[model samples]
Target chain A: MVTTVNLTALRRDIASLSERNALEAQAPRSAFGFGDRSIDKVLGKGLQRGALHEVFAAQMHDAGAATGFVIALALRSSSDQSPIVWLEEDFAAQEHGFPYAPGLNHLGLDPQRLVIVRCSSPQDVLKAASDSLGIRGTGAVIIAPWSNPKCLDLTATRKLLLTAQQTGVPAFLLRLGAIPIDNSAVTRWMIRSNASRSSGANAPGHPVFDATLIRNRQGMTGHWILQWESDNHVFRQIEPVSGAVVSTPAHRPPQTRKSATG
Target chain B: MRLTALDERAAKAGLFKTMALTDARAQFENLDIAFASPRKDAALLEKLADWCDRYTPLVALDGADGLMLDITGCVHLFGDEHQLRRDIHQRLSQHGVVVRSAITGNAAAAHAFARHSAGDVIEDSALTQKLRRLRLVSLEIEDVHLAGLKRAGLRTIGDVEVLPRAALAARFGAGLVERLDALFGYAHHPISPRCVVPACMVERRMAEPLIVMDSVERVLHALGDELFRQLQQRVEGAREVEASFFRVDGEVRRIGIQAGRPLTDTKTLFRLLKERLSTLAEPLDAGYGFDIIRLAAVRAERTQTIQKSLDSTVQETEEIGGLIDRLSIRLGTGRVLRPHPVDTHIPERAVSLEPAVHTAANPPVEWAPVQHPGEPPERPVRLFQPPEQIETTAGIPDGAPAQFVWRRVRHTIVLAEGPERIAPEWWREHAGALTRDYYRLEDNRGHRFWVFREGLYERGQTTPRWYLHGLFA
Candidate 1:
């Protein structure tokens, strides 16, 4: 049966409908690789866009792994039309001589499309992140130094999520060290070095390492290992480690507690 | 010959509102004033205009309801500026017009006086006295903010003048008192004129007013031609041109045009101006006919004095630039852009976008390491801002992906190559210190992908999660 709606009533209904439609709009989500395919599959088509994806180090010294993971993801995910915005917190580019430049280029990202904004203070980084969300055609924005607890406050996280949803751009946060695992993020996991292999008759043979996927948002965690080819600038996965190494100290760390799920 | 005796009864009766209100209207009334109420407008304005003409010839419209005059050098023409001002005011009063005239050392002071305090004429010697007598508010001072002064019993400018400025600043805001001092001329008060005064301007006063649009257009074209001739004689080319039409009904119509390359061609100038005018919603109307039409060269740029070359090739480049300029004006400035290279290792950071004309052709940055598309990169077609975390249970940790689920779908890894193991840039001090375990895993469905874990092996560590960074497809 056709319902006869009044003009004013219909207008009010339309207004509410639009409001509701906006409120109920599906939040944008994205998926980026850790340069690992098995892990990407379980991540629900990668990372969620228009949301904050966080990575924490096992310890402060292991920060290189997280950074490497982020740079690879940023380069791999970015398209020719849309670029990445890397937000730095008190990071001196000249002093480090563009640490991620070579890796990012090797990963097939155009260096010019990447706009790096150096922020001395957390306030600046947060403000810049919010502003970047409004820029059209920006694929993703990476906010590093996710360590400051204040950086990921509820207000900022919600804003980041809303911005990503609104614009369909992804945002990533890299913290200094492992934070208290909470369900603020859509997924969680831990990474560790693969068992080192004895190779090369020389001093420094090809570096062979393995990684463990300790957590997942929607699937079971497992272990993957590969060797880095310095000459080709690529990684080639090797055979699975023998059963002895599965529980050995090389791949598994001692008694790490699982992250609390939401 | 006749003796007059003062009689109290014959003297003017006590002032009444009706009797005190002058029937004579002002020359220029404020915008807020009533437009119609049995008041004479034209005759009163004519008398004022005549009186103002005696002061300067460059008088023009001011605000929505005001008049501005350029008294440069001409002030000396009328018996020392003071006498000239007094005579002008006396003439205005004789015509039953109330006027306020100010004769200052400069045009700004004169204008400020005419607008703010239109009373008695101020002489240079008694300028301070007149300024002191004027209310502080007249100098744009906030009255409610005089609390500190009230406590100190400082009532007037004269009172404040006696106290040390340093002491006064301590008691009150320094900026506030400094402004007051500047206004009073204790310090220099440099004034910037509202509009840039044209160095060379030409006006054509018609013998008879014109009402037809064709006639106005003819005058404009003629004026443009004449200005171009003058420019040619002086070896100058205008970058911007403005044509102004002043109507008898006080309506002004202005048409402005800009040139890509400075030129003084009347045909091109008219074409541009006509095109601009066509876009106007309201056409230029000479309500009561126009009395004057002026064509001015607002800005100019130098041109080479090269001999006229028969080279058609030379003209083409200039023509193209002109075309781009016109097209840009019609469309928008940022419609066309050029890509320039920047120094960065990240692929996306390689190029910057800028306006084609403004950008330098040379790349701004240089990088040694560059990867070509020919090289197989494990780069995903779509990359996430941050890698997504995933759960996995598969083969040994030291090998290719055995099996995993992404986006709620499970995939058994068949062919996978990675553990690229990109380390964190330690110097950046990123918040999420991650040790990523990156891998390129292919599912049984023939689709390959990249994924990584955010952080390295450790328990009780908060940061780091497994994330699917990007897709190969």
Candidate 2:
């Protein structure tokens, strides 16, 4: 006599699975405004707001330029009432002399709101960033680990990204090299300076940038070929590249798993 | 000596009659006056005190035509007490002050004899007979007692000392009796100084004054070492150190440094002093170079040494601090700052930056709640020093513009997500007159935008423009 499995037990197992699925569906999806439109669509609407959004700028290895860009971005995102926390590593080049404060102020950003923590080493910077995540009134935290030797490590970076994700304030890391660490970050992008024709006599030129979302969540990975108008400091899609516009694949969230070690 | 004769001449004049005359220099704008007593010719006592400093730091006015010095440990350096007193009198006479010389077993007798006799060294054998010969005025009695003694026809100190002590007290009052006894060495008469001498002080009497900064620094280092050795005698570290330069002329410049903690290390103390000296707008100039360099400890405290770790990282931090100190010294204190956290919702008020002074303490930081714990307002990535106005066509009759021009560029909105109204902070009068309706709008060209409505629709103000404050990365 062959015994058959009980119908109620199978049904109960199915019910538990369904309940778990329902709970997972109810969990709020992390979202942040890309502060751009097309990029937001590709990025699942802004960087997961309150989540860690890491962009690995491989070609943009220049820390100063990257620092300037981050400063501009942080200034753009901050308000007079709430400011961004900048944890700086050992990037003490002569050019880095206290100019960031006044420069940010000149560009329609409040200089007083920028909290610059000058640490001796990158480890200290990461520690300060991790510490900043637990602090309220801190809208965004910009960390550059590669600039300081002590902070240039795998462990601290992972810990920092984890803290950023948990707290929701975006942590922008300036990528030092070409190969992106996909697992350690939610989003990894490579920003290459693309050339554009000068529009008019006085207007310097059109800034065209080729930013590839090399790694993305939700299967939305592709390149964003855009024109960066220098005057406005904005990026607009000129035309989508062939592999640039990949839609989210149905049935599961896209996983571009990257290792903790880069 | 030359000064003793001058003092004898001044003693005949009775110039320095009272303690009041000793401090008379403080009232005068110029202290370089020849002392002249209206009562007598004893105008040389003041000059004598000024000249005596050349001999030692300790000097005081004793009586009319007289100056007293302990000279206990110092006299031996000048060969003997007689030689030291002789040298002192000679120096005084050179500067035109009359002074009398007297040495005795005690200060009171010496003071009395100095005022009355010439070169009197009263031994124990002749003490009583010598006291009887002195006048009542030399007894340092009060005015009433002197008048009483003169009325009673006992006008001499000898007459007063020969009388019974009980009868003297009964007739002339106790003050008269006591002052007589004090003057006759029957009671103690302790002398107090104007300024107490520091326990440890080192002075460099430069034969040739130092004019160069490097030389001055070298002198300072040597002086600091000497001062440190003096401090070491008492097992105390200097909390406050002062370097004083006395020019050839009458100008004195003092640079002082007070440490956060008591420090005895010469190099560290020198470095701190260097920072302070660098910040001085006017460099101290020694016209003919500093003739006298003195390092004095104004305040001292017990110092406990902490065993320093041999860790290289700790050393590096110290090095960085030193570098910052140098930079801060070069820049104005207001220009170089350390960001300190402030407890406030407003970003501008959240952190206060201050100069990197060694004594400045780390301010209290409200570290908990790493979230949007304070005011949950939307902050800009870039904050304008002054919020710039963006011209937007969003507030037209139709409301929410399909296309708005910012920085003179036309970008059409593909999808817009807010009129998230952020009213101006009502309490602040300086907040601009704009009720922002912030919208995270994407342009038709796929550029994400941060645009805000400056005013309301069909309300008080017309032409509501949108500001482009920041861009998304």
Query: Per-residue lDDT tens digits of candidate 2, residues B1-473?
Result: 01222234344544343435445344443433445553453444454453354446567776454577755576666787678778667755664645577877667778778877775656767877877777777776678867877888876677777789898788778877777677667788666653345556777777787888799888889988888877777778876677777765535677776554455768977877877786688978878787777777877767555467875444433433443444344433443344554554433344466554433223223333333222111332223222345655553453556677755667655445565677666686375656777665544333344466677876767566666544332
Interface RMSD for each candidate model?
A: 13.6, 13.5
Give the DockQ-based CAPRI class for model 2. incorrect
Q: Put down candidate 1 lDDT per residue, B245-272, tens digits, no spaces.
A: 7665445566766566666688777766
Instruction: Report the number of the highest-lDDT candidate.
Output: 2
- For model 1, the superposed segments whose C-alpha errors exceed 4 Å read A1-262, B1-70, B73-103, B107-187, B197-200, B206-209, B229-235, B281-289, B306-311, B336-473
CAPRI accuracy category, model 1: incorrect
Q: All models: lDDT?
A: 0.54, 0.55
Q: Give the number of the best model, judged by TM-score.
A: 2
* DockQ comparisons of all candidates to the true complex: 0.03, 0.03
* lDDT tens per residue, model 2, A89-208: 434322222223322332333444454555555555555567666443466777655432543456766776667656555677654433454345666655543322223321112333
Alpha-carbon TM-score of each model against the true structure: 0.38, 0.40
Q: Report the Cα lDDT for candidate 1.
A: 0.54
Q: Judged by lDDT against the true structure, how good is candidate 2?
A: 0.55
